[model samples]
Target chain A: MSLQDILTTGTAPKRVAAGMGFWKSLFSALDTPVAAPSSVPADDPLAGYGPQAVEITPAIAANQRLILSTRRDIDLQELEALCDAVGWSRRPVRKVRRALDNSFLVVSLWEQLAQQRRLIGFARATSDHAFNATIWDVVINPSFQGQGLGRVLMEYVIAQLQQAEIPNITLFADPHVVDFYRRLGFVLDPEGIKGMFWYPS
Target chain B: MSLQDILTTGTAPKRVAAGMGFWKSLFSALDTPVAAPSSVPADDPLAGYGPQAVEITPAIAANQRLILSTRRDIDLQELEALCDAVGWSRRPVRKVRRALDNSFLVVSLWEQLAQQRRLIGFARATSDHAFNATIWDVVINPSFQGQGLGRVLMEYVIAQLQQAEIPNITLFADPHVVDFYRRLGFVLDPEGIKGMFWYPS
Candidate 1:
């Protein structure tokens, strides 16, 4: 087909926010904690997608009750403040905006007040949706840290990746907190695949 | 705010196909090769958003002239056939559909005929649009390989990621192809930060 004919014919690849008809329902399902159907005889919401899914704990159940979303239409200044609150390295506001907007998955946590919700935790990941993914910039507001909100946020990220069947998840952790991620299933690099990277000279 | 209140008050994070607005123009621009803006002060098409971008390369110039897109409304059967052609690991049609639907970026190539566009090359990446992204499933119909089509396709992916200001891009390459990616400016990972991963047994 000629360029003109090809462009005019067949469905042009529309960017699916994946909110299209069926995927829309699935995306909505990700928004809420759904009960397993009695007819199915299984209570695990993620059973069909993959074998590995987190067993919901009391802490998770309570934390899940809080507002969690993959929403990108968030306040940047509010995000900037949340970054500051968590003692994160400084990132320019614009850089952070592009990052969040383009993130493959962003798990957002909020504290719902009488009339407004304040940002409380955030974790974002870059993934291929099939095989490999790397997570970065995980944070939970200091006041909310020990309350299992971080676990809820990370578990949500893990479940999302797991559901997509992406098995290779890699992250670089500081020496002090290696055990935190170890408990969540991350391990040291297997001997053969040395992690090599280059930065601006 | 209550869950109901937050859901109702703040935007429920409508899936920004992101292709709907400015990105649509860029997506369309990617479909058609644009002359570098010389007389115009802003030579960079992606300038307002980020600092780095690729000069639409010669290979890209040729490929763009062919017809390129991120359209997700694709035929799964056709994809299955393409996967068969490339000898990729078998993925069920449903899984292929879901993966394509969720990829952060997808670049498709077509050979324009009088009436139809035949899929000739394909590349995709999963990115957070900021810090990290991984490219995957880079395959070209064997008949279309070795024409620098792969380079053209990858350069497009790199440019898109660079524009998002995502600094860290990693991909697992076979030893033989390491130089190919290195020529395109990827380097060995830095020693201290090893790449580590885990999978469910």
Candidate 2:
């Protein structure tokens, strides 16, 4: 298939999966109303689940082992490896470092799926930190595919921002993922935000 | 004249004046062949030599002021003020704030022109902070008109950046100010950087 077909047509399966996952989670919650836990254990590996889960700090040191084991922030030593992962043109390490440092927030979600602490999924946000937030870099590592980790990560991040009382959050979903976000309470902003990108040649 | 006519005909000289002040300050060093100063005291009172100085920070306590000032940070309040000053409509402050915090290095320049610290000018840059910096938001106050302070400020900032040994510093200038930047060693970018603005009511 052509690139346009891949972007527009082949995305249906992912959308169906995301939609079914949203409904299943919603109905499952209604079916079993669990009591809200007062607090989560600091070291509880499963503390990220259910209501009343403890806060996840953004500090790398707080979760350094998880970060390192998941290989989330790998050094971009090779151009081909970097491009294969991010579809970005290869540039100097200095440039890549600068871009990574400038990212507003980079969130990595780890899950022990099939007996491995895998980088199930991740997302990056670009924002001014007070009022506006843009979600980007939503990806699921291929090894950890077919689980509901993407949705879990999304919901977790959304809850984090909501708890912080942030009012306006925005993101540009790949057209295929638009329906996924919509189902998760994001509306199709008719007058959506525009962004400009310049690549080093 | 209508507002559109005024803007198109360039009759609102005050707006132009503020813009010119910023442009002048940023490029002052290039006007003369003399080697520029190595650095200026961040609290240099002479920095506010132009017309529209706004003292966002106190001059006496330079170090403390830098700590307290959100000028370098993505400030929602100041972003609102900027939109108002430029006649743009309001937007979700969070998004703008994020963009500022993540992608831009904002520098707040102030001056004490009349025994009051006023924010006479400001500049934001998209840079690796090592190479390939693009400068934006060089503005000066209109009330503090006719002083050569604007040029001085520009020259000072550029010299500091140049001293860092980064090559390929760039900026986008309005048509009228193209020659101004040109004289300061910035050539016209034939493949201009993409720029867009959104105004929400």
Candidate 3:
């Protein structure tokens, strides 16, 4: 019987074989944790050359510039490497590429030294294009951490969303860096809005 | 000077007119709460006919069916009425329509009574179509509350996402209904995933 028939007639449907346990397994598949550690050590060559450093030798500072771009044509392998540098487990490159392509906007920060540019920070957001947007997978190259680049990247991303008139901004914060977001004016459980999730049995 | 020039040359950019306060105001716009009260009273015609009632009379149940659909072309006015029935503040119909149109999938549940159908529940999800999806604006016409249709609707939505291979599912929940979601195997702060919001300064 159709589900409608079963509902109206109170009759058991033929596909009753897929019971509650089946639904549980479906949710369980969602439980895989995709998280970056709260503390990541600098792991790249430019560790000492972060632009926000208090003191930099004139030669090193003159040629190095940090620039943000909305370019969606991100190099996937490089993104994977950046994620790895910040202690994220390997995510399938194909899935990561699809996520980037489908996102409403992608922002990348580049470190340019002389003629070479390296992808040092990245974040992307998905939005309804009018009402709300949530950022995902925000990461900065470990070599660029603690240099105020995360704040700059976040400021640029929020500015872009506001420019589009998407008024609501949200993100899933790892416990270790909740304060980092709080410093940027992010509130936890604001007006009783709490995040919920479902996982497989 | 361009932002790149400011960064590399240590020169203040001209538009320094809009400072941190401007950014704060942009985030503040997002602080408008779009929440449904955890306790909503029955306010519609089908208050007595929820299909899952153990004592539902045969006469009452014979002609009524609860059906779920993935129709994206939702009637925005009807949706507004249902949201009103559940005590949500009025959302501008134009923005609501845009939100629905931009969603990856929209699910609606209807109460079919022989010759007539009424919209009774609605929810929509946005997804990267591979790794993650977040459900939004879930509402059950208050008249149909406590009869298990909400659970039924959630199961259908989860099944649809699982079939599509979107493995991560999330939603923002009100404090009052945390247990309701937990009963369905949803965990709070799972693996230290906390929801954070950036609001106006």
Candidate 4:
């Protein structure tokens, strides 16, 4: 049988009456994989490309300028000039020093702005590396907001988590950001799953 | 106003509308500081709890007997005898050793079992402290199960976590045991919240 015939033969209905094979063969001829024309263009926004596209790396001191330029890390005095540019209050250098000691902070700096290497976005997670992980403080610089940087940063963080093979990860999001996370594969805890947060004033 | 009216005055429609307010008033009327409930009653079926209630301590060797008796950590010779009793094959000790070191292994027994006299059920977490905590291999031996020991252990762990102040905690449960955790205030991740597990051969 021709390749098309072979492929179509598999699609034929099983248990046909003895005299119906002829009709089945005719119907099967229409079952070719190529029958439907492709509607998506190479650049179609929704096309299934390979894996998600993004570059992510650990944040380093060298990227400080680009990061500070964005003023997202206003709590860090080193970024005070940038924060001033954006009308943010100057933060104490001691406060910045203390916050930097948390090991779980992973800042992603975009290379294109290397000279200005400000922390355009960052994520922080807490883990014991076996069963649980909690993600917090995920944010993208407002200037970088619409460029999909947040999603890219999140995907990168998730990939890192998958590599670590954590069994469960959880996060809380501002109610307004719920839809953004929902699209990124998060679900709301059910009605009864109350979260109690004790913030240090 | 009646106690019920006082309790119901300023509340959500559901809280006020539900008959729960009546029950709340009844409980409030009878509420008073009371003596602690007796530890698991002797006639309780779960009274089989004995050496199993051995508290976990920084030193674990002293409680070896209790540790070894648990289903998750059955004593090998005893297991062999039980296997012989049930006419099953005797497995190599290496099988148990391997199981103890598996990625799914979360609990870590310490140098001795009685030094501090506090039983611990701990799991390594997957991600960082800000987002989630996944509990794995959690158990308080049969003697400890029904006496709120598990809750105590969890509360201890939770308190430690609160110091870091992570926002969310998550865990997976066998389909049948989900409700037990639900009562402790865990809710299922919405549909499609997949939790993956890998077991070494």
Candidate 5:
């Protein structure tokens, strides 16, 4: 297929299904080339769209449970609210949704009340899954700042990547937070690895 | 599932399959949820494996067509050899393979000869597929370095991402190539976006 066809129609060429096929193929490739299950079992949770959330339980506050989830089907409204609480510029919900879907890994943090759960922080990473991963959109709700939820979020994300055997983990920080990342053992442009970006004209 | 289960078993909870399911779910989430087709139709290119490559036809040299493919099933040996040609440290083939499988986008460049295609240059990006993308492992074979194939590869990768509507693109480069990326409109920490990384202790 022509490059134009890819851009215009968004018809990914053969084997290029970005979501389900992509993830399954990756796992299969990681372990071995497994045959596609002739059919997903009727009771399999994975039979549905997104995988189930894996909640990370860590004590964050008294009388409240702090939890983190790898849920990709995050509620867009809750995420937007978290971003708003941090005073970040508003991004279109549609685009935000697309970003989450495209992300290799997404970690969402929440404060669980007696009856409800609130999204208090969010982070994501995209990776080549071999050499490097770059994280983006790390934010904690203003009310939850200074409680160390941000640190907890980052640590969990980093641990997960490391466990998966990903070698390098990176994130772009604002001037104010450069020291914060450093305290977490993140060195800036370590060994002279300079960061670069490209913006649309 | 408990975080321990996630770490130990690697059985991603509900929707966490990193390969096919992850990708399909993301796409469905991006557009709108669609019913999983009951069964794969025979002859569907996507039904079996990775997507086909899309060729960009711009002349790099006469007779020897410089081709870029989005095809993810790249030969790890060729990639390792290209890295060797450029004097990069050796990486395990398995890890390199996983990295490509996990990447959001992978661009492999080839020099088409009368007899066969030779792997010449390579680059990949990991993206949230919405807000940001980070380019990685950008390299050109020493034999092909001066002809500007590296620039062509970066431009095409950036353009595809921009067309997909992602807002930010990033990469970490050695000091030597920082200026090369700048000429392509990438700035160093534009507006104070400092890049940071964490390595295993």
Candidate 6:
């Protein structure tokens, strides 16, 4: 069920079968041990996301909603499609796979259509548990962007970092979106405390 | 024999027996797949590290020579001693062990003293073989700090990252050492492109 459906119906998500051990280590390494919330508030902003709702055959409507997950069960095809959709400088699939598996926290969004969960929005973070955390690859399918899902996805990331008690959340944004992040309460690094980075050939 | 001794003798240091499989994955995950350097330039900067030399009894001189290694065989005692010597925030030994084992690249330095090698310097890095890499914990024992060991250690790291063809090398520097990095060719993030980060609590 979609996170919204569960929030609305006061039910829990169907837990996916995976070793909780990996999650435990990931959270521990990131400095915040977490248990997914038992239930979110009824009026949660997240619960309001049937935004682009369309009346379809009842059978299809039941399955075609945005599902949000905090797991690493990404499918290769779906991941590549998302990468292509965002034009992420083509990389070998294995390279992307290793990067995904190594991330400290990953929030994946899927939209069910034709009984298949097609990846839609994806964001991953790397953290040192106690000190530094960075947000990377915050992308939503262009078709889904303005429906408020981008904000929905980013808000989920910020909230998770906050809950983890991670004090530092850093991301480099394309110049066009500086204000978008400013609205989320991030400011430029302190004056003279600029960023420096080198890139590979 | 120490790295310096190998340099002096113009012979390859004996490769340690360990899981090549793990190093294979670590390097693949960090960036490019690499083979050990085929040769060293006769005028290599690493060779000049022995420039500060003193004549003493063979017994006394043996205790002061610099040693370097790119292996993961460091024991808990040496790691702990190095951490204590640097006055780092104390952490459980297991936590430090986990971090060390997870590093993408680690360059460690020791001083051959009597029959034991005392940890004197270390730097580790994390990277996505494609885009960004960060240098962290570039530390040297205070006793060895002023004699250019830190420079030797960091130069080794830079050369490795350069060989990996990693595009972006980033590090957060202490205010006092900004010029040290500045001399190494890093510049402030371009204007309007400042860095933003949150600290872990």
* lDDT score of residue A186 within candidate 3: 86
Which of candidates 1 and 3 reaches a greater lDDT?
3
Error of 5 at B92 (Å): 2.6
lDDT, residue A196, candidate 4: 30
Among these predictions, the greatest TM-score belongs to: 3
Please give the distance, in angstroms, between residue B157's alpha carbon in candidate 6 and its true position after superposition. Answer: 1.9
Q: Is candidate 2 or candidate 6 better by DockQ?
A: 6
- Minimal lDDT window, size 10, model 1 chain B: B15-24
Query: What is the C-alpha lDDT profile of model 4 across A99-163, one tens digit per residue?
Result: 33433334443433333334455565655444445565566656656645566555445545554
Q: What are the per-residue Cα lDDT tens digits for candidate 1 across A68-92?
A: 5666667888887898997777877
| Fnat for each model | 0.50, 0.09, 0.74, 0.04, 0.86, 0.35
lDDT of 2 by residue, B1-201 (tens): 332243234333221112332332212221233223345456543332332222222232334221111245434675566446655568776556555664445555554334554454555555444444556556555543344444544544454455444454555455655565555555442343222221121
* Candidate 3 lDDT over residue span B1-201, tens digit each: 322233334333111222221110011111123224333255432333332111111222556755566777677888989999988999888899888888877878777686587888888888777677888888999887776667656655665676567888888888988887786667898878788888866
Order the candidates by TM-score, highest first.
Answer: 3, 5, 6, 1, 2, 4
Clashes of each: 16, 29, 7, 34, 28, 15
- Model 3 off-target regions past 4 Å? A1-60, B1-60
- Evaluated at residue A125, the lDDT of candidate 4 is 62
* Candidate 3 CAPRI category: acceptable
Candidate 1 C-alpha lDDT tens digits along B40-120 = 356322322112222222222233324455566667777667778988878767667767776777766555433444677
lDDT tens readout by residue for model 5, A90-122: 988888888788777888876766656788889
Query: Runs in model 1 with CA error above 4 Å?
Result: A1-78, A85-87, A92-104, A108-120, A126-134, A140-153, A163-183, A187-201, B1-75, B109-120, B129-132, B141-149, B163-168, B174-176
Question: Residue B51 CA error for candidate 6 (Å)?
Answer: 25
Cα deviation at A90, candidate 4, in Å, is 10
Pairs of colliding residues, candidate 3: A24-A201, A27-A199, A27-A200, A28-A199, A28-A200, B27-B200, B28-B200
Ranking by DockQ: 5, 3, 6, 1, 2, 4
- In order, what DockQ does each candidate have? 0.21, 0.10, 0.28, 0.06, 0.32, 0.23
